[model samples]
Target: MQLTGMFVHPLKSTRGIAFERAFAGKLGLLHDREWLLVTPDGDQITARSHPQLVRVRVELLPGGILLHYEGKPPIFAMTTVFTRPHRAQVWKDVFQAWHGDQRLDAWFAAILGQECRLLWLGAQSGRALKGGGEKMSFADGYPFLLVNQASLDDLNSQLAQPVTLRHFRPNLVVNGDYPWMEDEWQVIRIGEVEFDVMKPCARCVLTTVNPDSGEKNPDGEPLRTLVRTRRLEEGVCFGINLKARNEGMLQLGAPLEILEQRYSF
Candidate 1:
């Protein structure tokens, strides 16, 4: 197997940026999910609910991020050193996270036509993994999400319209020989980083939204087909959640070494 793609979503739910090389840290990729849009009460505003969010594109800048939307001027939100802790929530995991620039918040509020604030997870995340010890950013659950290209191809064969890897929002995409081969992988190494395959990623309606147009597929395609084909004990799964065992640089075309695999059923 080989590593084929690397991606990072600086702002949760917005368009993601593809990378040829990225640093694998404890909290997944370097700038992935560091920024998020939330309500005044701290609930996450994702593309799952607000499809318009997918229209916003984010560029990771040196000290901050650049936001781009159609017909609007690109906005730059600088990251300031935050000392105060503000309460925020991602799913059911409520924790103290830092708020971003007020100007950025206003920009988002006007775009979404709803009351919301932009938050930064700080230089280091305060949210701990469910079991404890390791910390994660604003990702739904695990630190990293891995998708197999072959698996997607298999799903496309059943679909009327094909979707790219962006729809699922994975940090890493590997080229494997067979479909769903990742299901049996327990441990794998990419470049200098080794990751523990944690669990099958339970997909959601967000996959039904077009990453480019931000419109829902009226047919409810891949997700609908996955329900019939890929449903496991844990929801409809299209990818695997991963936790980095060690930190290092991950480059495209890196060889994927399987250190361990699950026993055959």
Candidate 2:
């Protein structure tokens, strides 16, 4: 198999940026979901609860980030050094976030009718995964999420409407494979990088949203079909969450070889 597409979500639940090659970090891709939007009490807010956040567009430039949203003029923040820690929350998890000195919290609160804050994941943070396995980073659960192109094609074929990969929010999308073939893959080697397939990425309501518009469609279309065809004890099966076995750079179009294929449902 081979990597067909790569994406990085700089801020969780806002928007993501596509890339050709990306540095593999403990948290899947570098700068992916490193930042999050939260409330004053550190509760994480996402498009699952707030669909309007889909309108918030983020672009990572050489210096800093450019944020564009409805009713607000484009805001630019420099990539200068961060001093004070930005206070924020992610769901029930509370952590210190690094943020630019812009009035982002106030602006977001005013627009959303609640107290909201923008938080950036700092390189110095010691957040790690809690499972009894190799250390991982802040990625909701696993380090990396990968999907096969053929699986998407199969799902698209079943739907009356077309859905893009963005609906699934995978870190890596690989081609040259059949639907659910990745489930049997144990270890995947891409170029010099090696990753162990840890677990299956369960489906969620986020899969129903159009990543571009942040609009939530009827859930029954895809999720219902998946439940009937690919449902496990937890949820519908789609991709595999991977943990880095050996660290190395991942370039675009790199050949992927499955070292082990002993996975079972």
Candidate 3:
């Protein structure tokens, strides 16, 4: 199969930046989830709790980022270097992170209507990957998430109104012939980078949100359907989480070569 799509999420829960190619490192993609929104307690925030986050359009700058949303003035948050560092928490993992400017923090506070701060997970990150060994950005669990287009197509065929790939928020989307072929892939290589298909990614309520509007599915759809078909002991699983074994440049349309296959089922 071929790699058809590539994306980077600079900030957690915000819009993803589509790219033709990206540098892959320990964190999967460079600048991916390097910054994040967190409470004063360092707890991470997401569209699952605050759906408005998806409404924020993010454009990566030469240094910082440009954030745009409806009915609000655009704001630019600089990442030159965080002066005030804070303990940032994602799930149960906590690490030292730099807090953004009050203006940037206030921007998010005003938009979310809560006292939230933006934290940067730069090269100084200390949090270990879920299964141990190596560090990562503020990405949910693993360094990368992969989905097959054919699998999404299969899912769309079963839905009344198909959901977009944005809802699933995958980092790498591959073009494959059969549905759910990724379930059996243990290792895959795109260009020069090799990734271990760590485990099945547990789907969440965030998938029900409309990526364009930040509105949730009123009927509790995709999640409900996935529960009926893709449910696992962990949760409703759709995509696969990945950890890069080697760093390199990943380009779209590159052939996805599987080195090993072992089904969890």
Candidate 4:
């Protein structure tokens, strides 16, 4: 098995940027989900609710980020070097994050047609994993979410219209021997980083949103299909959540070594 793709979402819930190589931090891929969108009251807003957010393309820049949307000039938001710590929420985790200035707020509000604030996770994060000691950023739950290409291919073969990895929003994509082969993996090393296979990632309505158009599928595909085929006690499942045991650089085509297998194949 080998690493086939890597991606990072500088801003949570927006389009992700594919990379040939990425720095894996203890928290997550560098710059992955470092920024988040929230209601003025600190409630998180994601593509699951605001589907149009998927239309916003975020390009990470050295100092900050560039936001691109149709019919509008690209908006550049520089990283806030200094700011008062603002409180925000992601699921049940509430912690202090930095506000990205008023200019950025206005631009995002105009694009999304809703009042919202952008929060930065800051250089040091305070939210620790639920049962583990490692820190994490604004990702849904785990630091990394990995998907198998063969698994997606298998899912595609069952669908009338195929879905892409964009819908699943994985941080890493690997190709291995067969479909769902990653399910049995307990610990795996990609490039120089080793990750613990955390749990099966549950699928949600977000998977029904088209990354390109930001439109919810009228037919409710992949998600519906998953419910029929991959449903578990935890709801429909698709990918596996992972947490890195160590930090290093991950590159495309790096051999994936399964260090431990906890389940019988």
Candidate 5:
């Protein structure tokens, strides 16, 4: 199999930037899910809870980041260092995240109509997933999730409207044989690096958004399909959540091989 597309989400739940090549970090991909919008209570806001967040588009520029959403003027923020008063919980661990900029937050709050805060994952965060003898930085849950083009094609064939791979929000997109084949992949090797497929990523409401247009649609379309067809004992299987067994840079167009077909964990 070969890598087809790669993406990095500079901020969680916002539009992701497609890349030809990206550095793989403990967190998954560089600048992927490294920033997030949160409420005053430090709860992370996602398209699941706040569908309007889908309207937010994030672009990483040379000097700073740009955010544009429907019905609002674009906002730009420099990549300056701003510290949070206290550590906040994104998922399980309390992480020290920097708020992007006050003005940007104010603008978003005007739309969100709640006291919202922005948090950027920093180098000093020292946050990681705990358990299962695996480690991950700041991804929603898994370090890396990979999907295949054939899988999306298969799903699209069942739907009236075809969905793009962006609907799945995977870090790695590959072209391969069977639909949802990556779900059975236990270990895959790219270049000299090896990765352990830890789990099947569970489908969520985020899949309902059209990433390019940031429009929300009925979750039933995809979620219902996945539940009926791809449901596993663990969750609705779609892609494989991977943890690096050996770290290395995964270049674009790198050939991927399934080194092992089964793993206990």
Candidate 6:
């Protein structure tokens, strides 16, 4: 299978930045989800609650970030230094994170129409990978989420109105594999990097949200279909979460090799 798409959400649940080539690291591609937004109480905020976050554009810059939203000039913040520690909770893990500043906080607050602040994933972020000992960035769970094109085609065949790939928010998309081939893949190599296939990525209502308009499907599609087709005791799964075994470069059109395989389901 060859890698056909590479995406990075510089900010979680926001617009993704497509990359032709990226430097793979322990957490993921260098800038993937290195920053995030959180409520003043230190709770994480994402598109699940405010789908409008999809309209926020994030551009990774050296030691800073550039945020663009419609009808206003882009806002830029340099994070060379951090403020006092702010606790951020994701799933079951909690870690101390650095808040940008009042100006940065106010910028996102206006965009989100709520009291929210930006948090930088710095030395304070120590969320451990599920199986691996390495730390991670602001990603919800794992470093990488991979999807197979064939699997999406199979799912689309069942949908009345097929959705695009963005709604699923995969970090990498590969072709030339059978539908759901990643489900059984234990280890794979993309370009020069090796990754351990950790677990299946579960689907949720977030899948029903339109990636472009922030509109949600009232019928709860793909997620509903997946429940009937791909459900397990855990949840409805679409992609496989990956933990990089070794850091290297990953690029579009790179051939992926199944270095090892162990059928689980």
Worst 10 residues of 3 by lDDT: 122-131
Off by over 4 Å in 2: 78-82, 85-94, 99-102, 132-138
Each candidate's lDDT (Cα)? 0.90, 0.74, 0.88, 0.89, 0.75, 0.86
Give one digit per residue, the lDDT tens place, for model 2 in 168-196: 87888899567878878888898888998
- Cα lDDT tens digits for candidate 1, 1-265: 8999999999999998999989999899999999888999888899999998989999888888889999888999777844457788999999988885777778888888988988888987889987869898999999899999999999999988999898899999999999999999999999889999889999999999999999999999789999999989878999999999899998999999999997656
- Alpha carbon lDDT at 237, candidate 6: 94
RMSD of each: 1.2, 2.6, 1.5, 1.2, 2.6, 1.6
Query: Which residue pairs collide in model 3, if any?
Result: none
Candidate 5 positional error at 19, Å: 0.7
lDDT of 4 by residue, 71-172 (tens): 888988777652767888999998888885887888889977899998888889868777977788999999999999999999999999999999999999
Q: What are the per-residue Cα lDDT tens digits for candidate 6 across 1-265?
A: 7999989998899989889999888888788888889988888899998998898888888778899888878888677766668888777778888875788788788878999978888754557766556798888789999999999999999999998889899999999458987877899999989999888998888899998888899999889999999986558999988888788888898999998886743
Q: What local lDDT score does residue 196 receive in model 3, on the 0 to 100 scale?
A: 90
User: Which of the predicted structures, 5 or 6, would earn the higher lDDT when compared with the native?
Assistant: 6
Q: What TM-score, over all chains together, does every model reach?
A: 0.97, 0.89, 0.97, 0.97, 0.90, 0.95
lDDT of 5 by residue, 113-231 (tens): 78888776665555657665444455777778888889888988898887888788888888887787686677888766688888888887678777766666765667778888988
Q: Distance from true position, residue 252, model 6, in Å? A: 1.1
* lDDT for residue 141 in candidate 4, whole number 0-100: 93
lDDT of 2 at 152: 89
Collision pairs in model 2: 42-89, 44-91
TM-score of 1: 0.97
